[model samples]
Target chain A: MVRRSREPVLWAMFSGGGMIAALLLPATVAVLWIAAPLGWVEAPSYEGLRLLFLHPIGRLSLFAVATLSFFHWAHRFRYTVYDGLQLYHLSQLIAILTYSIAVALTVIAGFVLVTTG
Target chain B: MAKALNAGYKRHYPKWHRERVPIFWWLRSASYVKFMFRELTSLFVAYAAGLLLVQAWVLGQGAAAHARLLNWLSHPAVVTWHVILLATLLFHTVTWLNLTPQALVLRLGRWRVPKTVVWAGHYAAWLVLSLVIVCLFVGVA
Candidate 1:
């Protein structure tokens, strides 16, 4: 019998998160930070943007992006410290700490999204 | 009756590089450091997402809260941070898109898609997304 490791599952999440981040983050940053602040575009009113977020789809989308991005960070940082810093001996501890923070932040994101009405 | 061929065979010891990799190995090579910087951008990506969450929280609190949050975000330090993050995020996006073909191999029947084609597809998708976002933000769509 062959045994499998859980690394693949984490890698899948990381890859998925990468796709989402690549597809979404640039446009988001452009709109929120660049276009709006620089006045290159007619930025939405604060009330309008907030109303959009209060909608179910907007909240869900934000939560998904946040959750995936955090997992992406967790996976990347896990390798960064483990391999980049040559801390392979502390792999288990590092993974736990990194993943724990990601999960905690994800929960905080969820809390902020759902309760922000 | 087999010949004694084994009698003349010699055993050699396995050789190793022996030299340990230095702690700052990435600094020695531009390519290595570039790769490291690409990997490092994930931190800022996470930061951007977390900041968005905070904005959502503040927006939920009400107008004054959101106003204060926006004001804070507009500070010089915050603007500088955003600029840095935007650059990293752009790098992340470009590299991720460039590497997409390697990760995702699309097949049609017995034929495999060419990497350049796949790369072009990713760029096209990115262009469409950015345009749509621009339209939405500018009230063109």
Candidate 2:
């Protein structure tokens, strides 16, 4: 809260985050490339370990692009639940819901790459 | 009484938007702008939900299907739109990431939460998430 009241910035962030969320459907197509499917473009990968952090520069770049973008969304969504639902009394609950879902989503991505990878 | 006052504040501000380019005019009235920004930031939730869904679906699909998905994703027109969309979305994320703290705790009686920490924590999380994504994808691929 800015000494007086600062809700506009928050609202802007909310709208911006919503706009960004619109990109996911198309971005999902990139999953094909990352997965190395037969006809896919191979734009990015989320495989695992050796290549994950230690691999060549190319791999690092791909993960960086995908992950950074992902977290940004994570941060944005956490607040959405709180203010959007007017769960005014459930701030912590909303926080958990927001961040946990992000964690779960990212974890699921990792799991898929690990098992199928 | 405080709640009533606050409600009046919202009614006169962004919560009850009266026009189309509220954002454009928002700059004209700093107070209104701030009010609107707070509401707009919620878009991130939508962005995250979309990304997560993509992750789940992509992971479930096999190589062949994944490949087809990529071919479509890479189309020149598609790529252009994707880049434009990503840029705008990131704008949404970065600006809002800076506001998460206050948003999390809009008000706790008279004790309010600081937004700086909220934004910083998000940046930190981005770094960690980035690393984790790198580890998983590079290794698997």
Candidate 3:
């Protein structure tokens, strides 16, 4: 029997992450970069944001976003190097390194979020 | 005899020259560059989320730590990077919204959802989600 490919699973996460990132990232950037520095809107208080993150929902949300976004980058960058840069010969190594980093970072995010408080 | 047969087959099926892709092939077309840039935005997206993870960690450390993190975020270099991230991510957002219809096709009974409706739906979701996050941060219920 032939082995089944895991590409679908990774692609699913990549596409899901892409959707969420596309929807939410711009607004988040607006608040952090544009609004806070320029005062287009009153900047968020550190304590207030902190308290928000203290909630379980907030922590989980951040973890989901961070992990998903990392996977998205890993998937896209993998293809970029494979096709865009034409490194098909290094496919196995590239996939291993890219996904390992994404998984590692995601684990770090989860650990930090859960244990920090 | 074998050599002669192989030579005849080679002549019958001429191999075409392969075109080499240049290092900067992406620069040759506007659309290719746009697509590559869109793919590149994934890195910025991940970076932003990583910053948030750091923020959550610092927030748990207490006010002093949180304050220090905020101070660091305000540095000139960090601010400049954030600015570039914002611009590129905005481009990512717009392109993503436009491409959603292509990715997801919804049909209601026999009728297909209009592409415009799909685009509008993405924007609407973005608006709602952004409002909720903003509200939560601003201490509004």
**DockQ values for all predictions?**
0.52, 0.12, 0.57
lDDT of 3 by residue, B8-123 (tens): 55535777796878767898899999889989989998988988888888888888997787777778787888889989888878888889889889999999999889989998
Q: What is the lDDT of candidate 2?
A: 0.48
TM-score of each: 0.89, 0.39, 0.89
lDDT of 2 by residue, A29-69 (tens): 23332223333433354333223323345333433334444
Which TM-score value belongs to model 1? 0.89
TM-score of chain A of each: 0.92, 0.42, 0.94
Error of 3 at A68 (Å): 0.6
Scored against the true structure, residue B32 in model 2 reaches a CA lDDT of 58
lDDT of each: 0.83, 0.48, 0.84
Candidate 1: the clashing residue pairs are: none
Per-residue lDDT of model 1, residues A35-109, tens digit only: 676566676677777766667988998898899999999999899887788777899999999889999998998
Which digits, one per residue and each the tens of the lDDT, describe model 1 over residues B60-135? 8888988787677667787777778888999999999999889889999989999999999999998898887666
| Chain B, candidate 2: TM-score | 0.51
